[model samples]
Target: MNQERFKTLQIRLSGLSNWLITLAVIGILISIGLGWLVKGILILIVVIVITPILLILGVQWWLKRNLIQDKCPVCSQEFPAFNTTQFQCPNCGEPLKVEAGHFSRLTPPGTIDVQAVDVSVQQLED
Candidate 1:
């Protein structure tokens, strides 16, 4: 899941970087080479608007991908899961939950295969 999200974010960032680079080149040409003040200002506005948004999204993707953890929706703190169960936020002591659903990719094999045990007894003239 994280891998898929990371890959998607990476592709988006790559495409945004390419566009930013192209716009930057154009801004440079307009500002310094041609001295087109209005066009340069417009391009500068676009740069200022998009750079921080892209940076924030990139950071979010990196944290989600590399941290290998989940963020608590209650306290907004990050935590790890031991099994398919609920937990609390360590930092804020808030009640939180972590449900990975059925057949998660992170779940280990044979974890859910076991069922109730069976017992048998034989008696003779008891």
Candidate 2:
């Protein structure tokens, strides 16, 4: 029975490792395909196609292997680990509680501040 249990455990671990590698490979493939298809799309495809898969795999592996809840305090967003102490809520600006895990690589929001050009000039006396 002990040997059987050990074999089962080994099989489970090997399966998990294989799954993670598959996810990483798929993400890379999708990213490359997107880049080739869209010349100017930038990193949008990565965010849309790859992040969710990685996040899911990370969260699952972390939760199962480590007997702790690695989740964001605010918005209840779940992560693999809480490396960062502070995180801006993805849904809102409210700060979330982070454990000792690294925060997701979030892209900063883009903004445009337009300045008006002044047409008036000072006249000089001749």
Per-residue lDDT over 61-120 for candidate 1, one digit per residue giving the tens place of the 0 to 100 score: 866654447666544665575445555567776654445521122234565634567889
Q: Candidate 1: which pairs clash?
A: none
Prediction 2 global C-alpha lDDT: 0.61
Q: List the candidates' TM-scores in order.
A: 0.30, 0.22
Model 1 lDDT-worst window of ten: 100-109
Runs in model 1 deviating more than 4 A are: 1-35, 70-126
Best by TM-score: 1
> How many steric clashes between backbone atoms does each model show?
0, 5
TM-score of 1: 0.30
Q: Which ten residues in a row are the worst by lDDT in model 2?
A: 98-107
